[model samples]
Target: MYIAKINIMTKPEILDPQGKAVELGLKNLGISQAQEVRIGKHISLQIDAQNEQDAKEMVENACKNLLANLIMETYQYTLTKL
Candidate 1:
């Protein structure tokens, strides 16, 4: 078995309203030190595969096909044996 940890975020050029809102809220709460805050999604999946390469391919496919929006978002993942 393997585990995949995926992180998906909006492209750098894309506007992130939710991230802006969170930054504003942080500032309102006196967290002025926080700067350029961004929001993203983290996903973990348990996969049964023959090897690391296969598990990685499956995770990448999932990210490209369903998890991240290629037009506005990007993704990265880490795979580990479970």
Candidate 2:
């Protein structure tokens, strides 16, 4: 089996209100050293595939079809044998 770890984030050109809120919260808490906070989703999946290439394709399809919103979000994944 292989494990896939996917990270989905809003496109750089888009504004992230949640991230902005978190950044504001941090500044309010006196953590001013931090800058440019952006929030994202991390997804993990287990695939019963024969090889890494297959696993990658499956993960990519999932990302394209269901996991990420392609219009505003981008996704990246890493597949590891488990």
Candidate 3:
């Protein structure tokens, strides 16, 4: 069995309002040194697969079809054995 970890985030050129909000909150709390913060989504899945290739294919498909919005976001993944 393996665990697949996926991260989805907007492109750097795009504005991140949520991240900005968090930065502001941090500043208000006296962490004024905080420069910038980017927020993204994290997803994890457990799958039974024969090898890393197959597991990677499944993860890529899931990212393209459902896990991410390709129009506005990019995705990266990592697979680990359980």
Model 3 regions lying over 4 Å from their true place = none
- Clashing residue pairs in candidate 2 (N, C-alpha, C atoms within 3 angstroms): none
Q: What is the clash count for each candidate, in the order shown? A: 0, 0, 0
What TM-score should be assigned to candidate 1?
0.96
Whichever of 2 and 3 has more TM-score, that candidate is 2
Instruction: Check candidate 1 and list the clashing pairs.
Output: none
In angstroms, the error of model 2 at 49 is: 0.5
Error of 2 at 71 (Å): 1.0
Candidate 3 lDDT by residue in tens digits, 1-82: 8999999999999999999999999999999898769999999999799998899889999999998999899999999998
lDDT of each: 0.93, 0.94, 0.93
Residues 11-64, candidate 1, lDDT per residue (tens digit)? 989888998999999999999899778899999989999999999889989999
- Point to the candidate with the largest lDDT: 2
Q: Tell me the lDDT of model 1 at 80.
A: 90
Clashes in predicted model 1: 0
